[model samples]
Target chain A: MKNWSEKTLKRIWKGILVAVLLLIVFTFSPWVLVKGKIDPILFSMPYHLWVSILSTILLVVFTGIGGMVFYHLKLKTDPNANL
Target chain B: MTQYLLLIGVLYVGVLFFLSLRSRKEIKTSSDFMLGGAKIGLILGFMTFAATLFSTFTLMGMPDFSRNNGVGAWIFLAFSDAVMVFFILWFGFYLRKRVGSESFGGMSRLLQNCYQNKGVGYLYFIAVFLFLVPYVAIQIRGVAIFLIEAFPDFIPVWAWSVFIVVVMLLYSELGGLKAIIYADFMQGTLLLIVVWLVAMNCLDNVGGWSALFEQTANTQPDLLSPPGPKGLLSPQFLIASCIAIAMIPVTQPQLSTRLVIMKDYAALRRMAVAVGFFAILIIIPTVIIGLYGALQYADASTSSFLGSVLLREQHPAIAAVTIIGLFAAAMSTSDSQLFAMGNEFRGLIGSKGENNLTPIRIAIFVFAAAALLFSLVSSNELVLLARLSFSGTGIMGPMIILGILAKKPQGSFMIGLSAVALVIFIVSQLGWIPQQIFNMRLDLLLMILLSLGALINYYVKK
Candidate 1:
């Protein structure tokens, strides 16, 4: 199969880029946005669990979409694609 | 402990033998034996996957965890089932559509092609076999101990071991994957019925869910919580669990075979939803059984009951439920392991050799014997053994994901990840690393590092 089409490649790269952005924002950001005050979301669930669950969902969804795009690209390029 | 159950065990073995002999005519070629020609339908696929996943470990160990920790144990069950579902939906379809190999070892060859390294392929093969044998043997010993308890006066532990070994070996040797799947389907159904009955009985005895929850909350609140037991599980553990789940869709042998067996991606996606639901349903009864024991026997030891009972020379009806449940769990896992190992041996050795069946048979025996030996010597907890094996496979998870995403993975990337994994493994084994390192989950660390390692290597090489 030839390389992925520009559009499909761009779609995959976009998904990965979004995931990375979310990771940086959520993982590294402070628990309380306004200094000494508490964060409402952190109280409901542990900060780690909240971050983990959110990141996991984001990673699985983005990677899945990326995988699907690449798969379709391969199929489009290959004359002998069985699927 | 129960005469009726003893009769059932004998009948179960006889039926398995009959099925084994019956399926021999359909096993002329290696493919037929190894993968049933990859023609498994939805029903067989679902049943086999359910049976293989819900082994004696879940039956015995899950409850033990619940008894000690509480709902946190359910997280383990949930993550495992989730991983299986993800695998069915994502990688299973593609792997089947592309490589279409029968065993995990065959998939390793595909990964080797991506990374361009034979050493990595061999490491994957060896790692799978080394860990799988002990896992299989644990099941064998579980079955043996169950029989010994059921027929205390008549059957010895060794005899029961021999009987289970012979029965599993005969069916696997003769009927191949098809026979194992059929047996697993029946066992899975029986286990489901029996587990639910036991759960209902336990609930009745414990005064229902409210009482059960109250008792567990008072005694072990941490078990019910997310982190669990102060230091045992942390955010790192959950992170590892998710990474492990993502890897499951790509790595596990039983789940991977489901991909190759499906008719198409649609079938696989449908199967994923079904399998996920079934797995969740199966785990509920297991959690209940474990909680029941925790409530009733306030101080029952966490380890195997056989030695404790032998010291006391008495057996209770509750113990019988535990025994039967343990038997179900062990059989489910052993059946899957046997099928996976048989297929792996056939794929690797049968491709090159003239006397294929002999090598396959030898591999089966060697695997069984080694596992039995290890089980005999090791006094460690069964769950600990299972966890160690899980960690061993954690290293390969990132590489498998990269294989799917990257068309041309760098050799240095593969070697670096393998080297890091090897170092972690050796450090853990040698006691050089702090205990917290072992306690703290490494699955997430390995996956993130390996992914970054591959990405960086790709760019550098380009």
Candidate 2:
């Protein structure tokens, strides 16, 4: 049971790591590759709107990373950490 | 005006009622209600933090400051967030590790453990309650005014106040922290969208950043500079801003709760970065909007048609969006304040065990009523109220820092800081003290002396 829980936790952490990296890429990438002028429906909105959307997305991603890190830290600290 | 406000009031009351019903099953104990069973994940936590931080003051007042004072106000406000984030990163982990209590009030308990003095615990608890209740009342008043101003057809200010109070009480009583946080998450997202749209619309109306800057420089160059016409950005203002920044984190009940809800040090660290970034995004636009308003209506007073028309005369499509944003900002903070005050009141009445939350419900009503009464009687502007709250918290700021540093902060030191802070607050409020003293602002001077006194006591004991 302990081994299985450890494996599951590890997998969750790995998934979170990939998500964080993807979020970082999405957040930093400013270039939108389109064959023509930016489509209003697809890419155009107010600048502040775009910033809010990006900031909210980043906030969620970072919070996920924080949760995963917390779980791992708990696992290390407790004698019977996993339920 | 009253008829429209009534509709808004009814809508808010209905929402509160629904939330209350949904949350009824969740409130099994004080911990469940107060800390959400300490099981809140990152999403809810982030939202709750965001909601509490952005109040009606931020929604309405930030723009107002920018309009009157310029980008300097924005910078000063942004500096508070940066300073708070830095402190969170530097000290949050340590505080969380050392004192695993669930509330800022719990920090007082920790101090008692260190000093073996219940009086110290009582002092901390009293200070938090006295200041936080008034701070919460300020938020309630801000929301009432915003509602009255925004939806004159559907929500009368008094009815709106009653509606908000009822809604907050229901959700808070029923859902506890869980309901509050979930509501906060939704409200925070809505507020972010609403403010962003307002900023965009304002920019578009003003013919973009360059035009806005040029207009300000050409028409009202003095307003573009620090210490605008009122000298708000002078060294005295800057010093006061810095002191406020430091003191804000220590006393803000919403931010202090972040420590309790966090899962661990890593979560706290991530929260710091996320919250810091959000603060930047949220504040800058509001400030710009204020400047936008100023540029558009250089001679218009806030009470003038220009001020009202700029915000309210949006396109039909965006009108609902603007109202929602304003509502979200007001409701977010109002709900959190209700929850915090409820908990504090429970503690004050000496309630414990499962019955602790009973007084909280009553306390919420009392607080809401007090705020409503104050709103009716007082015409103190939002910025002035905000500054007063910040300065009020400055009294407890040194003691919070000292409690963290000292294994045993002497009872005398805590009492002394409290007394001195009280005197300064009273003197400033009474207008006996000059607004600027010794080329330093009163708040800055008080904070310096408080810190120095605490440090001296620490060394003397050592």
- Tell me the lDDT of model 1 at A16: 61
Interface RMSD of each: 7.8, 11.3
Report RMSD (Å) for each prediction in the order shown.
Answer: 6.3, 8.7
* Number of the top lDDT candidate: 2
TM-score of chain A of each: 0.49, 0.49
- Mark the regions of model 2 whose C-alpha exceeds 4 Å error after superposition: A1-83, B1-20, B101-115, B151-156, B303-311, B348-354
Which 10-residue window in model 2 chain B sums to the lowest lDDT? B302-311
Write out fnat for all predictions, comma-separated: 0.02, 0.00
Error of 1 at B239 (Å): 2.6
TM-scores across all candidates?
0.79, 0.78
| DockQ scores for all predicted structures | 0.09, 0.04
* lDDT score at residue B396, model 1, on the 0-100 scale: 72
